[model samples]
Target: MKRIPYMLLLASLLLNIYSAAVWGFACYAHSGVAERSTYYRQFTAGSDPRTFSVGAFTVTLLSLIVFIAAVRKLRGWYIAVAIVQALFALLYVWQLS
Candidate 1:
């Protein structure tokens, strides 16, 4: 029961990392246009990358808030996760731009 928050936070972090990676691959990879479009379409189910990025950011923010509110004892760990999440969010924005 108590592990749920931790799991959610971990999932959030992984999702954010994945979103960044997909964005990077789509934007920077030296693949053919058809291949890149196919990859992006498959990964995002036909949605825009920016929309997917926004959804990932929203999930990360909600999960972090829940984790922090539900687990008060792991101050250091939560703080570190928050910082890493922030960095990921920044990276996402930079890549999108």
Candidate 2:
């Protein structure tokens, strides 16, 4: 496409990065000074912040990639994939939040 969806791409990239960060945080965040407690455990234990971030990351990456491909006129269902990916990401963020 003549115009690259920079805004969409940036948003998607940021959201994906945010999701990755949260995922990494869950794996690294400490709950106390005495133990190696992480948000990952908290999420698996009961809370669900990690899930949100993960889902967002997955959706965002997929959307951004597909969007770029579609805009660039790459063969295949790029637009559909992008739509699905973006929608999924939004839903994940919304559900978790």
Across 29-56, the per-residue lDDT of candidate 2 in tens digits comes to 6665323334544434543554545755
Which pairs of residues clash in candidate 1, taking residues 3 or more apart in a chain or in different chains?
none
Instruction: Give the local distance difference test score of model 1.
Output: 0.75
Per residue, candidate 1 scores C-alpha lDDT tens digits across 13-39 of 988877667756976874676666667
Q: What are the models' TM-scores?
A: 0.73, 0.39
Candidate 2 structure lDDT? 0.57
Show the lowest summed lDDT stretch of 10 residues, model 2.
Answer: 33-42
Model 2 bad stretches (over 4 Å): 1-4, 30-58, 73-97
lDDT leader: 1
Candidate 1 — worst ten consecutive residues by lDDT sum? 30-39
